[model samples]
Target: MSEKMQLVIDGDSVAFKQSAGFEFRLNLSEFPDLVKAHLAKVKPTANTKSTQACESLGAEVLEKDFEWEFLKPFIRDVCRWGGFALIYAKVLNEK
Candidate 1:
């Protein structure tokens, strides 16, 4: 192939009273390894605000509640496809 490609990863994590989940979306990018959404584009597509119903939360709590069983394989595949492990992960807690 004579062409190069770029990638962007968009991730969202939401925490509820007793459960939390994360979704990551990727698209072909015009910038290399773009990992964040712009200020105007940063919004949760999921109905997390209403569901959370919490004034504040913590990463440790969300991490404890997140589904690592599914997240591990997804992270593994992303790493394999990217041919490197330059991932920045954070537990998303809201206030």
Candidate 2:
């Protein structure tokens, strides 16, 4: 029998087949570092928009919503792979 891992997000469940084609196991609970690293990218951009605009015109704008901004790039990158996790995360409650 193939070993399967189940991931439930927003009441919907997805079964990841670990033995059929892939040999890896994904432990969502074990990704604290990954989560932290992703959140860290948003920290610098936490400043208010008015404060950011006061800087030079050529200066980069630190996105107000870090989580949302980060996902934009990620969604574009994963467009070829089909968007499952992005939708899943959008519906899931992190808090």
Alpha-carbon TM-score of each model against the true structure: 0.22, 0.23
The sequence of per-residue lDDT tens digits that candidate 2 reaches over residues 6-91 is 44342333334443565344456656776677555533233222222333211322444436655444343333223344554554
Candidate 2 segments whose C-alpha is farther than 4 A from its true place: 1-15, 18-20, 42-95
Best by TM-score: 2
> In candidate 1, where is summed lDDT lowest over 10 consecutive residues?
47-56
**38: Cα error in model 2, Å:** 1.6
Task: Estimate the lDDT of model 1.
Answer: 0.35
lDDT of 1 at 18: 18
Q: List, residue by residue over 18-90, the lDDT tens digit for candidate 1.
A: 1133333334453234433332343333322211222122343366574665445444444433334444142
